[model samples]
Target chain A: MKSNNSFRYFLIFAGAGIYQWAFWHETPGLNISIFTAFIVPTLLFLYPESVKKVPFWLVLTGLLSASLAIVVHASLFATIMYVISIILFVGFAHWSQTKSPVFAIPSSIANLVLTPYTFFAFKNYVATNNKKSSVFLKWVKLFVLPVVILIVFFTIFYNASDKFAEYSDKVLFPIQDFIYNLFGNITFASIFFFVHGILLITWILIRNKNTNLSDAEKNQTVNITRNKVRRKRHFQFLGLKREYLSAFILLVLINLLVLAANIVDIVFIWFGFEFKEGMNLKQFVHEGTYLLILSILLSMGILLYIFRKNQNFYSKGKILKVLSFAWIFQNLILAISVGVRNYHYMEYYGLAYKRVGVCIFLILVFFGLITFFIKIMQKKSSYFLLKFNSWAMYLLLIISSLFSWDTIITKYNIKHCKELDYEFLVHMSTKALPFVDINKLSTDLSYKNPWIINSNYNYDYFYVFSMRNYYVKQVFNFLYDWETDKFLSWSYYDKLAYQNFMSNPELVKSYKIYKDYRIKKNQIENGNKNSVQNRTPALHSDESR
Target chain B: METKIQFKTELLHYILMNPVRSEQSGRVVFSEQFAIILKIITS
Candidate 1:
């Protein structure tokens, strides 16, 4: 309380408590935009020394990502971007102070999580500069663990036995009442938010005074050095000339192989192959997916090997360089080939998480090959390749989050898919529920007729029908859960979905019917299972019908 | 004719091969029954 920076510390702590009370008291919103607003300013204003040393573009990008959270519809993607932005900015900021680049992310993350501990355990002199604070720490050290254990035991007993809970309530009611009156109805969730806020600010302020990872990457240079050849005891096989020849030959071979594969894909898959309804599409594109992955990995390996040293400096290196560029170009086509393969697969089978993941992976490969091209032209070291590709990955990840993939998969599959995997569609998110509702499907004639959509999959018609009912039940349950979760654990898309469901009269009517159907269906089926005589008649009559 | 087949198949198969709900809902029932028993015992 009496340190030189005691008031500043108090202000930081009070800011956390007030922020928790204001925007966070319930489930804390997990709203990264709001969080970023608090964090960026607090760190800048209070601990300018730490955040300001980062380059202008880096800081601007961090701020832009933080601000994007406010502009974009809140999603898991925005949240991840916000977190990674913070981590990168802080990590780089901390790493910059150490004069390093490539390994900043890991070390800075370590700093972010462990800062409060580091601050309290070693740097407590900044906080507890008074004699009374030492006494307080001693008291806390002796009592906190036992008090925590007691509280845990009490909670377990209270939950396990109603008698014990009632007895404890009777004894503790007056004290609880007194505490409630004194604190104006405090909750564990609120306390957690308050503590989290303090920890976040602590991370912003006192993070990684000692940089570990940046030091490791401090001397990481971009240029690949050419060492003068010193003959090592007749090991002529280890010569750079031989290495260049071998890499050139390998590239020439792979280039021809990949070009041939790409030609087949372009001719058949891109322009010629047609999707039939009953094809085993699950196996058709399955092997193609792995081939694309292996090709991409192999291309990277080829580039890394050929460009490992001064092979690019040889007299006949022009042809090798041509071969390398040609190889990268062919690999880019191979990436496009997978994109087409995925499209064909989705055309028949349907768009789901797997197909979308392939699309994203293709984008990553495209960036990687492009970076490889750059690495060859610039003679950039392996670390530059790592660094540039990671940046590309960061951008791609943020962009990918902009769309609600679940709803897109659902709507897209329903609109265009030749065959529907009913089980998987049933298991999809509530965001796509209305799109698949049987009543809605009937009204919306643009889509194929209900049977036609889910038909070609090799399952019993009855099984698919029951699945439709189950899907309806799922939607109803989701809306019910949304109603209860109005303010608690708020998500933008979920809330928007709730509003849309409530406003649509047809959807509401359908929900009610589905709910009623599930109850009746359960009762009738249970009764049939219990009655042996009835079961015999029902089976016989079903056959007769 | 297709609609009739679908309806008949749905009616029969739904009863015969409904998903095993009891495997999941059995846990829910046990917890609910436990709560009731606990209430009675405590009272």
Candidate 2:
């Protein structure tokens, strides 16, 4: 008994010690001081089953002072460490079924201050905006993004950090990194997931495929689906037992939503944008996360409505049905709209022109659809369905592979490249043109007496031209039919500008006029804009290798 | 009969007290001191 007692203490102490040592090496200065002070006390306080006898509040105050010693410069790491400690405490609380842990209040307050700072850092640095006004305002979408990212990264640590560092360093640096990564790209993927879940619930309705039943039977089926009950014998969370089946279904829906949203974003980005706000299905789904949070309020509303209408069976039933159906219907509408838009994109891009293959695919699909409908109507399916499904999946995989191969081949060839006629590129980004000698641009050119000027050292030609000014502005406008008076980075295509002028000698007259104007003024105001207007041919090929 | 009850209690306590051995695979598999203590009392 004594040996076991000693062993348990030894493991915790040893593990905690190793974690602390690793942290000391990784963290510098004030972080080290505060961590060193807090580690021993945290272990001591947390170790006891009951600190009520030993003045827990006084001990917490001491812990708080020590934690506060952690410097702001080390805020990123310290904040993360604090968050991890909070999470650990949460786990402890869960296990013990008590929230009265050592330094609970002080630690909570410290985290409330520190966590927001980490979020703000990400916003100011990564998100790159000047929109912040108050401390609270700074902790908006931008703040949430980073904190979420941090949580994800911490949750999934590599073997090197989790296993090796756990014993050697008592600090939670890996956890901090995890949090930063989570907030980094939550909007695009996270929102999609939320919407995808709602859509999936609706999709289950669409995919039900039990069409042969009479209206009463259909209604019965719908009722069965709607009033689906799940029973659980033993499992519990938050002191409440859940229906295991319902929980599982909800989890599945959540996972599907995440996957679908991610896929939508990926697919939309892969194809060029022709949408308002350049938002894909992924972004739309992200907007749905804001909607899902409304579920709590909606649930409350549903409960109240049920209480109010408990006497009227029809009203109560209708209210419940509407509450359940609303999410599904909204999700279905979103999915259908996005799917149509995707088809429209396919048509516009001349991908639909290659419809011979698609026609054959449609014929095969027609047969499959007929068979599926017939089976559902007759309530009859073959035993060989599993085998058939496997074969069909394999065939689909092959077809998909072939399609990808064709697309890849087509992607590389200049024959399929979108034509950017010379006039458009010349009008967009002359700043990217190599007409200005790199040597002269990089250094100030003093041809006349003693006037000195700063040289143009914008080496980021690719971003300034193709990505920002050229493709984003002019091309997007032409594609989407959206009018924006302001020109953006995508408008420029220097290659097109050069091609337009090169076809005829008459184009040089505009260049000559610009040259004469420059000679007379000795400087051109908005030279970049003017140069784009009277664009020259690109020095190299337009198609990027 | 007394010995059997004590043995059963010790077994129950051991099962509850010990950290599941399967989880602590590669790293040093230190025997759980707490479980051993609980076991001793029941024994």
Best by TM-score: 1
Error of 2 at A537 (Å): 46
Ten-residue stretch with the least lDDT total in model 1 chain B: B1-10
Please tell me how candidate 2 rates in CAPRI terms: incorrect
Please write out the lDDT profile of model 2 over residues A107-161, one tens digit for every residue: 3333333433432242332222233324344456668889999867765664437
Using Cα atoms, each model's DockQ against the true complex is 0.07, 0.00
Candidate 1 residue A247 Cα shift, in angstroms, is 1.7
User: What's the TM-score of every candidate structure?
Assistant: 0.66, 0.19
Distance (Å) between predicted and true CA of A243, model 2?
29
Global fold similarity of model 1 (TM-score): 0.66
Query: Across residues A122-165, which tens digit of lDDT does each residue of candidate 1 receive?
Result: 34423344544455457769999999999999999999999999
Error of 1 at A227 (Å): 3.6
The docking quality of candidate 1, as DockQ, is 0.07
True contacts kept of each: 0.02, 0.00
| lDDT of predicted model 1 | 0.60
Taking every candidate in turn, the Cα RMSD to the unseen true structure, in Å, is 12.2, 32.5
lDDT of 1 at A457: 26
